[model samples]
Target: MSAGKGLFVSFEGIDGSGKSTQARLLAEALRADGREVVLTREPGGSPGAEEIRALVLQGDPERWSAETELLLFTAARRDHLERTIQPALACGATVICDRFADSTRMYQGLSRGDLRRAVDTLHDLMIGVEPDLTILIDMDPAAALSRAKARATAEERFEDFGIGLQEKMRAGFLALAEEFATRFAVIDGNRAPEAVAEDVLAALKARA
Candidate 1:
């Protein structure tokens, strides 16, 4: 699904998988190629989502449960889609997102263990739009976690996570990518950022 006239390309992986860097690189690459690109992130992009993102990522843990966190993410995604993503797509822009529906399916589903339920909740009632392409950056969880620990400001409710959970999340992402291989491209995020960007561009061209 082109999601309409434009393309919806998303970046997804575990927390420290370098999606932000790749997304920026891809956006720059697209612009350099003379295409209009919009760079955005889930639980963000729009004002409402940004606020919800702060609440979900930074608020007291006591205020949010697994289900609550999932719901907040859904709300942010809905708002982001309606206010930012859809319009950008409709205007014929290539929307490069830092993360999307897959992130929720993997993270929240791993945290809650009901992947089907999470997927159902997000798409069952919507207009039913899926991504055109999903770039999944593959990185070793242990190494990614070490980098995150060294660089993070305050841990999210999920980032205080054990190594086991991070591994589970990584596996979940890979499994989900397998399920949607046609739209999923796994890039080696363990390499240098420049190298990863090159792989990303090549993977995208291959997909195209």
Candidate 2:
């Protein structure tokens, strides 16, 4: 779909790199700066997407094959874009989303190598939008995994993949950032939340 006038920023990283927290902080910071900001997340940003989120995130890890899970994620993303993200941008609101399509690429592509082609193809065919800027919170997988497990939520399907998979996911994200250098900012996430937030803002300012 076509992009709207406002800025679209997405936060991505391994499961517990604190990307979500950073997204929230960035949104608050931007709003305080007098910008209209919309804070949202993927897999459940909008009403219809939230339903899909439950089916994907709350079930057993084996509930769907890699390809099947990719389709489900694409469907939820379609709804999320149409209902929440696109509309907010159309209205000139900066949209800060936690976990956009990159999560799908890293998780599905790295987990099931063959599905990487399918992920890219389906994304181009059905969801042809990319974030204006993507903030990758790069960090150590072991530390991130510890944080993820400590949260102990029902949506632990991805987190249950353990430290090894998290390591792979981290590498995938870094590779993605390299591939899309113009639209990505890789931030060191092994720091205090406030420090990370400051770095994030600095990165955005530099980009601007």
lDDT of 2 by residue, 8-27 (tens): 88999998999999999998
Model number with the top lDDT = 2
Lowest lDDT block of 10, candidate 2: 109-118
lDDT for model 2, on a 0 to 1 scale? 0.90
lDDT of 1: 0.83
lDDT of 2 at 168: 89
In order, the Cα lDDT scores of the candidates are: 0.83, 0.90
- Which model scores highest in TM-score? 2
TM-score of each: 0.93, 0.97
In model 1, the clashing pairs are none
Model 1 stretches astray by more than 4 angstroms: 60-63
Indicate the residue-level lDDT of 39 in model 1: 98
